[model samples]
Target: MTGGEVAGLIAAIAFLILAVGIAIFVLRVAAVTKEVKQTVSEVNKTLDVVNSEMGGLTHEVEGLLVKANTLLNDVNGKVATIDPVFTAVGELGESVSALNNSTRNLVTRVSGGVVNTTKATVVARAGQKAYAMFKKNKTEQPTK
Candidate 1:
């Protein structure tokens, strides 16, 4: 071959090698892009499922809150209804305590003023004599 032809042939071969390397790089980039697209699609699908589940969970939580509010209102109403009963019970206890105090005071006053030991002894002796006479009379009478 002539010198020009040989140089031309070498140049052509180098150009061919460079083209082949570029083509291979482009194919690898395409494959990676396809994989990235598939990953994005899967991520979108997962996000959609999660969003749907969250909606249901939100609905259930709202229902639970409503029930809780109703229960709280019911309990508050019951407490209000029975509030008077507790007050009345407290009043009753106070009244009973006052009555007990009054009774104790009355007993103390009566005992301090009325029934000395001498008077009690005399009363007891009189009751015993009266009982003995009544029994004697009953025994003396004939049985009906």
Candidate 2:
């Protein structure tokens, strides 16, 4: 064969090798892309499930919040109802303390008056006895 024909044949063989390499690279890229697509699809499904679960969780939390608010309101109402009872009890305690103090003062005054009256009676009786004794002695003796 001539030199030109030999060179052309070498060029054709090189081009065939390049084409084979490009085909192999394209096949590898295609396989990777398919795997990436499957992974993305699975991730999308998982995200959908998580989103649905979050929706239910949000609803449950809202219900819990409402119940908590109701419970707080009930507790507030009960506290409001009991506040007056506690106030009344405190007032009653004060009134009882005042009554006890007044009773103590009255007892002290009555006892003091009784003691004074008894002392006065004893002194009057002693004076009368001494006067009678003096009169008896004067009569028994000569006129003085």
**What TM-score goes with each of the models?**
0.51, 0.52
- List, residue by residue over 1-144, the lDDT tens digit for candidate 1: 999999999999999999999999999999999999999999999999999999999999999999998997787678558655555554555555555556656877978653233443444455445545544654575542
lDDT of 2 by residue, 3-25 (tens): 99999999999999999999999
Report the CA-based lDDT of candidate 1 relative to the real structure: 0.72
lDDT of each: 0.72, 0.71
Report the error of model 1 at residue 107, Å: 2.5
> Model 1: which residue pairs collide?
none
> Which candidate tops TM-score?
2
